[model samples]
Target chain A: MVNWQLYLLMFLPLAFVIVFNYVPMYGLLMAFQNFDPILGIWHSQWVGFQNFQQWFHNYQFWPLIKNTIALQLFGLVVGFPVPIILAIMLHEVANDKIRRFMQTVLYAPYFISTVVIVGMLFIFVDPQTGLVNHLIVSLGGKPIFFMASPRWFRPLYVFSGVWQGAGFGTILYLAALTGVSPDLLDAALIDGASRMRRIWHISLPTIRPIVIIMLIWSIGDIMAVGPDKAYLMQTPLNLSASQIIPTYVYETGLLNAQYSFGAVVGLFNSVINSVLLIIVNFIAKRLTETSIF
Target chain B: MEWIRKLPKRSTKGDMVFDIVNLGLLLIVCLIVLYPLYFVLIASFSDPTQVNLGHVWLWTRHFTLEGYKVLFATGSIWRGFVNSLLYCALSVAISVPLTIMAAYPLSRKDFVGRHVITVILTVTLLFSGGLIPTYMLVRSLGMVNTIWALILPGAVGAWNIIVARTFFQTSIPNELLEAAKMDGCSDIRFLIQIVIPLSKPMIAVMTLWVVVGQWNSYFPAMIYLNNTSLYPLQLVLYQILVQNQSSIGITSSPESMAAQQHLAELIQYTAIIVSTIPLLVLYPFLQKYFVKGVTVGSLKG
Candidate 1:
């Protein structure tokens, strides 16, 4: 009954996780050390709480937290409802072929890489050659330096995120929507219910659990905004708005070669993310009886 | 039933208005999504100066292959392209099998230690050692600037394992495994001959996701590889497109400075197209599987 073959299959993957996932956790000890590459983790001078205290008191700490939270909040607030709305709209399209075609067109951008997306943003918004500026000029307005101005960073980031991800994000909601019974919709129709009313009463309620789950997941991820696109979109002029924690870790840790300090900052971010996830999950379970636990 | 089938679809004035509004909004959303991509395509072919002046809007004006010509001639782009392809291949090779191996055991309820192993792996999905420690570990392993640096550290993701486990559990019926066991089929033999062959769709989904993920990723390369030759396409594109550094080595004489600048701008558009074309080409064929992957993965295990 003991599947020794299954145990053998598990061995390599377990080894992989132990080395790749857990070892780095062991490497987290470097956060408490005045980590020297030559001295390594074992020999490095242990300075308990020094790195944490240093980061907590650092001048950039509050700005980093503020920027990280601000971007994530903006993304969640602006980006969250878009997919739900999109899914509902798609569901309402009675013409199957038109719905499919629209879905295809919308999802195409999701395949574009982050580098290309940011690159496209720069090209389209460029002061001289960009089409957006051209439209502005033709419409009797001055050209705005979208990439350079710190003011434009968050909007640009969040909107571009929605543009790329909203269509793709609808996949889950649409899947849930399809599970709504035709019999229920027919009954609503027989009662002479309007399309809007039917959707409000039937489709929305059907997908509410999915919506709640997604919202909880999004809330949990509020502190863990990816550094890739933001880092790519970052310019010297936009650093004030773009210098979030992950990017800060990359800059100060690897780029600046402050390994231990970078580790401390990254550890801080991860701890906050973990704590937030637990808190959000617990709250969701209490309120909605639906959680990602 | 006959009357129900034959009757015209019921629509009140309110429903008509709602449908019109919904379709109108969706049409706008579709255009918003499509235009930027269309503009990039047209701009790539248009004259760089004309593009800059906004003379080329809906279509290419003074159409030229000059930008693409410049891009194709660049050694870094070519190197980056090959490097990216190599990394993706290596990553897919490593990740797909590792995912299957990890997922299969976890999928089996009778497999001893499954719960403990599942919990161990799932915990990784929630938290990690963070970037710096991971980077330090990679550096300590002397994977810096090597191909292994890009592919090895992230070969198996906990999420992918979970997704594949879900697939195995749901699709590969327990009865089939028991039947195979009656014939004295070993677990490895059953997996190779029965489970894997039957799970083609799941494998395709996993492979496509891994390939796409590896293709698009540049963070690992940017972090670990110091050598320009090992740089992936995204990293190279980053320098060219994001930093506005011209990888095309055009001589900058004072008189030709404007011309050089124009060519550089053209190359940026061209680079975006070239780098993106592969994924976009594969997307239509692969989209269903991608959708399936998302839906299957999203299901509560």
Candidate 2:
């Protein structure tokens, strides 16, 4: 018999998702309207495509797109392979104690919150007395103002992400790697294969599907580059390098109280993510015979 | 000599080289990962003057708790600590159970509507109304600046529900569930009595995730809450670190301005450490659970 009690159990969570998640989708009509907060969504004049037109025609649109894509690509390029390499090296460790110790040490930073990590960055890269600046000065160079400079923003953001996240990223890949049969490794060794050769042939192939899956997900996630850290790091000085789509919406909609225009920009971001996800999944299906949906 | 000889021997010179190089790389990475935290630890305790001079390194120079004393002396920090605890506790209490309930049905093999529900839910991951609409909805409910605004909107995460569902499906097997069903148990009873006990490890992982997530989150607070009394520790941290609210160490004398400035820097380090203490203490015990969670969760796609 089908259990109605299970339906009863799922009731609140389903209600939560419908209210918090799906109802918001229905409210996306504000993106099409000239929304006045006091006038509210229903009473707001529905000026078809006017909000989108404003956002698309805005001078900030292309730069926001470029910055978003550039930052994600930079992160993908640097941050993606680090955990894979780390896991491989970890997988290679003959000594279990050292392997576990390295894993424990590496994963610790992942526990540190983003705000704290950024705080650490502020303290460590302080132009006058920061650790980075101290070394720079000791080496007979000028102590660079890291947080103030626009040119350094993406590098600082992406690399700090790697530092914070790479260790934890290894867990998934490492889990996948554990599925490689010991018999295959034994066979490779018996064939007088070098350790590198075995890793390249056996280990690499075993993990390729997961790698492809992660790459596709990262590509799809380009538009959803969270505004939190970027918002925190933005200075009037670095707005050129730092203003991404999320922050732009937050500034326009929330901060400047341009709710409709903000929704238009934010809706653009969501659509781009959806499109990229579908496109990437299509490419993945064709190229790798792997797809999430 | 015996211990040295007991070490795992490599079959080839190439393997030996790889081991040595691997160990070296791991050591450098460990140092790189660890040094910033170590510096913060020492710097919090070191003399503010020495710290400002960039002389504080591996150990505290003229150790003192002045930074912490100054940090804790503020009324806001204590208020933030208690508020954060409340938010974190409420959030986990609500979210973990919601996640489990959603997961239980989705995990069922014979639940005909589960696929439709899942596909509907998964679409939210790819695209949605985005920020303004969500904020507007929260506002519509008169939830702005309320604790419920923080707790309710984020209480049920679809992705985590999927992860927990997968854990239930794979780990707790259909056969086990069928056996329970045959024993004259109602679905609610089966859940509370049987499934809940069996899912302890997953629940523990889910609890840790929800708690850490709630503790770390401030963006929601920034958007929703205007009241200072409602400020969580992370929001307080945003003030200290990003806003650089060095007003806490503002000068009593212009003559001691430099001293005040240095103490301000020291206080920043202390504030980061203080805000992070719950996490740092709980992390070691919980690290294994994260690995397990990630491993299990990533099995979704």
Q: Distance (Å) between predicted and true CA of A230, model 1?
A: 1.3
DockQ of each candidate relative to the true complex: 0.64, 0.69
In order, the Cα lDDT scores of the candidates are 0.88, 0.85
Give the alpha carbon lDDT tens digit for every residue of B1-301 in model 1: 2311123378766766677788889999999998888888899998988888999878899999999988898999999999889888898889899889999989988887888988788778778998888988888898888989888888878888888898888899889999999999999999999999988888888888887888888788888888898899999999888888875666768868878788888998899889998988888787778788899887654
Report the lDDT tens digits of candidate 2 across residue range A104-215.
8888787787888888888888898788999999999999988888899999999999999998889988888888889998888788788799889999999988888888
Model 1 lDDT tens row, A1-293: 65899888988988899889999999999999999988999999999999999999999999999999999999999999999999999988877778888899889888899999999999989987788999999999999999999999999999999999999999999989999999998899899887778889999999998898889889999987778988998899999999999999999998998989999999999999999988998988887776554
Candidate 1's displacement at residue A19, Å, is 0.9
Which candidate ranks first by DockQ, i.e. highest? 2
Q: In model 2, state the lDDT of residue A115.
A: 82
- Residue B186 Cα positional deviation in candidate 2, in Å, after optimal superposition: 0.3
Which interface RMSD values do the candidates have, in the order shown?
A: 3.0, 1.9
lDDT per residue for candidate 2 within B180-227, as digits (tens), equals 878877888888888889888888899998888888888998999999
**Where does candidate 1 chain B have its weakest 10-residue lDDT segment?**
B1-10
